[model samples]
Target: MNFDEFTGTVQHRLELPGTGEAVRATRATLTTLGERIQAGEATDLAGPLPMEVDFYLTGAVAEHGQRFDWNEFLDRVAEREGQTAPDDRADVAHHARTVVAVAAEAIPAGQLDQVRDQLPADEGWGNLFELVEADGAQAE
Candidate 1:
């Protein structure tokens, strides 16, 4: 439901190769989001939630030494790296942005239904996000 329970469930249930570190990184990112919200440094619409989630995922990917096509978009938008000027890259950025926006909103809703709807069907981070959503909903 909350961060602690969500993290705990991930630590227990998920069996990804590097889920442990991912779980830890996720918690840290969520904490940062909470802090930013408290400080009024960000809002849900400005895309802080998705940006933070990607930032957290980027770190986890680097830490695990895993490669993903989405990494570049994560870097370009989340890390504010070089502009993605080409038409294809622009499309990638747009898709990632939408994914982030949905996931971010689901995180706050803390409902399994909402999280599952937002998560990608690919079954890694998406599954973990769903787990958090489920736990959050159960708590309520």
Candidate 2:
């Protein structure tokens, strides 16, 4: 998908106010994800994405493969999303899932799996893939 289409899909999925919110959601989720996973894996995941959106994975990562658990991942994403309230974590997680689901659709098959492999399933990191997993089940 192109940049507009990708952001539009995310906007629709998250029911955000506009493209700007969608962009922010995408940025927040992917950038945080980029930080959590290895740099090479992040680059691989970003490969099929729109260049505009892919930069969230590429441009913002200061250290790839940084070890962080799911809660820390959500915290960073929430901060990037400007959701300061402690109660906003649920919403932040939902937003991240939505963005990831949209991204799973955009990238080639198996690419997301590589990204998934980088995160530990035992640490609740699998929660981020809930939507993607559901979608896969439905497709099957």
Candidate 3:
């Protein structure tokens, strides 16, 4: 998908007020994800995405494979998203999941799976993929 379509879909999925919010959501989620996974993997995942959007995955961070857990992941995303309230974590997670689901559709086949492999499922990080998993199941 192109930049406009990608952000539009994210806005529609999250019911956000506008494309700006969608862009922020996408950036917050992908940037955090880029930090958590390896640099090479992040580059590969960014490959099929729109250049505007892919930068969130590759260019935003100074380094990758930082080895943070799910809570830290959410914290970084919340910080980037300007969600300061402690109570906003659930909403943050939901927004991240929505962004990632949209990204899963945009990236090439198996790219998300590679990203998934880097995150530990037992650590509750796998929850990020809930929407993607549901979509895949429905497709099957």
Candidate 4:
């Protein structure tokens, strides 16, 4: 998807207030999610995404092997999103879920699956896959 289409999808999914909010949410999630998964897998996932998004997910990272669970995932998102307030974490996570759901549309399923597999299931990051569900239930 193009950048506008991407932002539109994320805004619609999250019922976000505006395109600006959607942009920030998208970037925050893409960057944070990139950090959560293996660098190689993230690069594969970024291959089919838009240039704007690809950079967000794969820019300047010499390594992307760090692993963290849901909480840390949200924390990183909040930091990237500039939502420094403690209460902003929940909001960041909520937006991040929508961002991932929207990202699912752009990423090839196989590459997306690779991302799912790369997340340490035991650490709870595997829950990221549920962000886009057939029944419309997102990762919690």
Candidate 5:
């Protein structure tokens, strides 16, 4: 999928009113994700994505990603998404899951595997990709 389709699918999947909200969710989730994933993994994962999608992960932090768990990761994404209200938790999880699911559809399987495998195994960070994998499985 190209940028338009990618964003459109995000909007449709999330039942958002327009591409505008999808773009907002995508940018927030993807950029914040860039901050959590290793620079090299980010680059490799970005390689197969559309230019617009890849842009978010392109200038990843110089250091190897920060040590943050899945909940904090969601918090950052929710914060970046401008929906920090106490009642926004459900919306935040839905946004994160939806955007990542749609982007996962556009990414090449090989690259996706590299990403899932490359992430740190010691931490519960596996939850990061769990949604994407589950989404992919459901699609099949």
Candidate 6:
């Protein structure tokens, strides 16, 4: 429903907070944790895991503020992620715009998802990804 909730769910599923690199210490931890789980060496899958990470972004363009709608935000996230939601577009758009403003100001190129994970699920990730994609497209 919100960015934090969404990220928390993802982090829980991944069983580890992501490190900045595609492969890093977190990967090693996951492997070991996985082995432990498989061996029944650990009782709870969620508890033994390390602390969740917060991948925030930073840049100059990120400072200029903007606004978006929550419904639109959800729709965009669903659209980008290839999922479906039964919410009205207008309502979601409002939250989306607000989240976009925050991401636009805070995130840098390398840590969009990290920063996005900190946002409300219903409002920030979609706009943040859009900006990241736009920047990536322009670099080509």
Quote the lDDT for 73 in model 1: 25
Q: Candidate 4: where is the Cα deviation over 4 Å? A: 60-62, 135-140
How much does candidate 2 score in TM-score? 0.94
Candidate number that wins on lDDT, 4 or 6: 4
What is the per-residue lDDT of model 4 for residues 1-140, given as tens digits with 9 covering 90 to 100? 68889888888888878999888888888887877677778788787778888888899454587766788888878887889898787688778767777777766556666777767668756455566765343212
Every model's Cα RMSD, please?
A: 12.0, 2.0, 1.9, 3.4, 2.8, 17.5
lDDT of each: 0.36, 0.88, 0.88, 0.75, 0.74, 0.33
Q: Per-candidate TM vs. native?
A: 0.26, 0.94, 0.94, 0.85, 0.82, 0.22
Model 1 lDDT, full chain set: 0.36
Q: Give the residue spans of candidate 1 off by over 4 A.
A: 1-6, 12-14, 39-138
Candidate 5 Cα deviation (angstroms), residue 5: 0.6
Count of steric clashes across candidates, in order: 3, 0, 0, 0, 0, 32
TM-score between candidate 1 and the true structure: 0.26
Write candidate 5's Cα lDDT for 93-120 as tens digits: 7787777777777676666666656556
Question: How does model 2 fare in lDDT?
Answer: 0.88
Better of 5 and 6 by TM-score: 5
Clashes of 6: 32
lDDT of 4: 0.75
Residue by residue across 5-52, what tens digits does model 1's lDDT show?
444434444332454543443434333222222112223322323353
Which is better, 4 or 5, measured by lDDT?
Answer: 4
Better of 3 and 4 by lDDT: 3
